[model samples]
Target: MLTLAETPPGAVVRVIEIMGGRGMRLRLMRMGLNLGDLVKVLSSGPLRGPVYLENLSTGVKLALGRGVASKVLVEPQ
Candidate 1:
């Protein structure tokens, strides 16, 4: 498993866990990210900026801050 931030661009991965407080988890959930969901790494901004991701199940694309991405654990699919 690896953090979402470490996932390579275009890689499809499954979300395993989100390591943060309840508010953080709820925020991600509201964005369509949840445990066991498949997420694709779309693109990463330069200079440690936001990382773009696509939720395979919902077809939603979102940008996550580096810090948040680092807390999202994923396994390559």
Candidate 2:
């Protein structure tokens, strides 16, 4: 499984698994990112910076730190 951190820009991916605790999951869910949702990577900052993406399901855009993004498992759609 590829992580959101490892996905390149412009790739549309589906959320498969979130390898973290309830707090993290809830945080993401509140941001409109949930399991099976489709998202596209908009851009990634340099030097282990945040990852910018758009949740296709809700049309919400967000930027997540690399550490947080690494826990979000995804598959290309």
Top candidate, metric TM-score = 2
| Tens-digit per-residue lDDT, 6-32, candidate 2 | 999999999999999999999999988
Shift of residue 10 alpha carbon in model 2, Å: 0.5
TM-score: model 1 vs. ground truth: 0.96
Runs with alpha carbons beyond 4 Å of true place in candidate 1? none
Sliding window of 10 residues with minimal summed lDDT for model 1: 38-47
Clashes of each: 0, 0
Pairs with backbone N, CA or C atoms under 3 Å apart (clashes), candidate 1: none
Cα-based RMSD of candidate 1:
0.6
Regions of model 2 farther than 4 Å from truth: none
For candidate 2, what is the lDDT?
0.97
> In candidate 2, residue 34 scores what lDDT?
97
